[model samples]
Target: MNWQQAQKDFEHFLLIERGLAKNSVQNYSLDISKLINHLSTNEIRVSPTKITGEILQHFIYEVAKILNARSQSRIISGLKSFFNYLIFEGYRDDNPMELIESPKTGRKLPDTLSLNEIDDLIAAVDLSTNEGERNRAIIETLYGCGLRVSEVIDLNISDLYFQEGFIKITGKGDKERFVPIGEITQNYITQYLENSRNRVSVKKLASDVVFLNRRGNKLTRAMIFTIVKNLALTANLNKNISPHTFRHSFATHLLENGADLRAIQQMLGHESITTTEIYMHVDKSHLREVIKDFHPRSNY
Candidate 1:
């Protein structure tokens, strides 16, 4: 197939078969188009089916020179997925990215806020206005539940179970899990809903959505980021903070306070225990205390 036809087919597969959104499909196509452009610039005349491992390796090498390690890693991963799709569709016999190794980058541990820092951020909110109270509630929920930003925005009134003390979170791939909500967070949400949200003229479609913008539409992920960034600045927090920082802090604090790792794993919706183990690295004092309290020779 010609490049144009192959591109069209790939786009259709991404949209119809994979069920990816328009922007996501566009990003995948853009990654492939970059490779196509590279081949053209190098005077190589190989179609998607005929692309060899050596050519792919050279393309990655050239890309590495131009992009940072993280960007290069992302591009490589995107290309691998694209080529894997081509192989799955029987358009290619072998995957050129089979031997492509991602760059060796150290795992940067996620940033976390101390309880004081979290308090500072929440206190920075001006609760004089309706939107201000809603924003405070949004921040409280994010830090309290350790929710992903998307999960926070998509939260519905029906998902909250304050009496049962659980909030059902729908995560990636539409997977659902129930997380325990604290009384403080519950009270904050209750205040927002009863006092702030109740006064708003919410849009019909967004009536059930827990957090709404000034326009009464569901909050966007970018808006959440902007909210957190502004709050951090207002509170004079020097550390680079994001919504995910609260999630890290939540996990870390729980682990430090003698909460079981397995229970944390379940609450955080981590499929693997190893993913939850990262929190174990954050607090060495907790480990020392555990050994002192439980070790057989401690009394000696």
Candidate 2:
């Protein structure tokens, strides 16, 4: 099959069969696109079904010059998945990437804001404007609930179960999970809904959406990143931060405070405990505390 057709088919498979998010599917397609670009640039004519391991290895070598080990690893993984899909569809007999190995880039820890820094970031919001309460509530929900940027932006009014102390989150791949909402977060959201959001001229399409622009349309993912970026600048924080910093902080703080890792995993909507275990590596002090408190050799 042609590269273009193969890439299109792979995208459809990822979205329909794998149930991947649109953003995820696009990322997967990008890997194939990169390979196609490489072949065209080098004047090498090869179909998806006929592309050999040598061609892929050369392409990877070229990719390494432009990308870091971690990024290179992701591209390799994405390519592997694409070829696996091709094989599944009976387009190819043997997998070419079966022998390819990703670079040994050590696990990179996610950046997190300390509690005081989080407070400072929230306090930096301009409260005089109409969007002040809304911004405040947005930050509160993000940090308090440990929500992904997409999840917070797509949060719906109907999903708020205040009395039940939970918010329904539609996570990656449209998986739904109920995450407990703290009283502090609930109150901030309530205030925003009652004051800031009620005053907006909301669009009919975004009526159910909790977060919105002044035009009352649903906030885009870019807006969320901008909000966090501006807040970081205003707070005069030297470290680079984003909406996900709040999420990382949430899990790290919960782990530091002796919360059960499994419970944190549930609240964070992580499918695997292994995914949630990264927080364990964030705070060595907590681990020391555990050892001192429970280990039999602590007295020695």
Candidate 3:
């Protein structure tokens, strides 16, 4: 099959079969496009089913000059998944990427914001304007509930259980989970709902959406990132931050305060406890405290 048709089929497979998020699917698509670009630039005309690991290795070698180990690894991983799909569909015999080795890249810890930094970022929001209330609520939900940007944007008015002190989040792959909301976060969201959001004229489809644009449609993920970026600039904080920095800070802060990792995992909707365990590494002092407080023979 031609590169275009192969990529189109791969995209459909990822979305329909694997149920990957849009950004994730886009990343996989980008990797295949890069490979196609490499083949075209080198004047190597080869079909997807006929391409060998040797040509892929050559492409990897060229990419290694510009991409770091982590990026190279991700590209290799994406390509492998794509070709594996081809194999599963009976479009090819043996997987061409079977023998290809991904470059070794160590686990990179996510960046987290300090409590003071998070506070300053929220404090920087202009509360006088109509959108200001909405912005504050967005930050609070992100930090308080550890909601991903997509989850926050997709939040519905029906999903809020204020009396229960929890918010329902639709996470990756359509997984649903309940996350507890703090009093402060609840208050901010309530105020935004009662005041700013009430003023907006919402679209029919987005009537149940909690956060909305001025025109009352569901907010884009990019808008949330832009909000965080502007707030960072207004706060004059030097660290580069995003909506995710708040989520990381949420888990990290909870772990530092002796909250159970499993509980945090449930709230964050992480499928694996290993994903939640990264917070344990964030605060070594907490680990030392756990040893001193709980371990037997600590006095010795």
Candidate 4:
């Protein structure tokens, strides 16, 4: 099939068959679009089925100059998924990316803040303003429950179970999990919703959304980043922090305190324990302590 037709079909498959979210489908399409752009720029005319592994490899090499290792790896993965779909649909005889190797890169550990640093960051918020209160709740929920930025923004008031001491989080791929929320965070969110959020004239659609912008709309991912960056600057934290840092910190802190890895994996909404194992790497000293304390006859 032609590049354009293949892209259209791939999008349909992702949305209709795979049930991927719009952003995910867009990302997959964007990966293939990069190859289409390369072909157009180089004046090479070839259909998707006719494309060879060598040509794809050359395109990836060209792309490596513009993207970092992680981004390039993501692009390769996306392309591989797309071609695999095509193969399933009988559009191609075999996958071209089967032999393509992602660049060798170590797993970069996420930056984590200590409890005192977290308290300092929260204290730095200017509560005199309406947005400040909402921002406080945002940060608290992020750190307290180990939530992804998307999950935090998309959080609904109905998802909260303060009486049960849990908040239902809808994670990647629309998977839902209940995470325990501490009393401190629960009170902060309650105060923000009751005082600040109540004062704003929220839009009809955003009424259920827990966090809102000044215009009474749901907060965007960029807005969350801006809030966190400003707070980090105010607190004078040397560690480069983001919303994900809070999540990493939450998991790291829990793991350090001897929380079960499987339980943390469930709370973090990770489908596999392997993904949760990253936290083990974050605290080698904690692992050593565990080994010393738990191993039989360890006194020696």
Which of the two, 1 or 4, has more TM-score?
A: 4
Query: What is the C-alpha lDDT profile of model 2 across 238-300, one tens digit per residue?
Result: 998889989999999998999999999999989899999988888788789899999999989
Q: Which residue segments of model 2 deviate by more than 4 Å?
A: 295-297
lDDT (0 to 1) per candidate:
0.88, 0.92, 0.91, 0.92
TM-score of each: 0.87, 0.95, 0.93, 0.95
TM-score of 4: 0.95
Give the Cα RMSD of candidate 1.
3.0
- The C-alpha stretches of model 1 lying farther than 4 A from their native spots are 1-46
Q: Flag regions of model 3 displaced more than 4 Å.
A: 41-43
Model 1, 16-87: lDDT tens per residue? 887665656787788888888999998999888888899999999999888888878877888888788888
Candidate 3 minimal-lDDT segment of 10 residues = 278-287
RMSD of every candidate to native, in Å, equals: 3.0, 1.5, 1.8, 1.6
lDDT accuracy of residue 287 in candidate 4: 80
What candidate 4 gets wrong by more than 4 Å, as runs, is none
Clashes of each: 0, 0, 0, 0
Full candidate order by TM-score, most accurate first? 2, 4, 3, 1
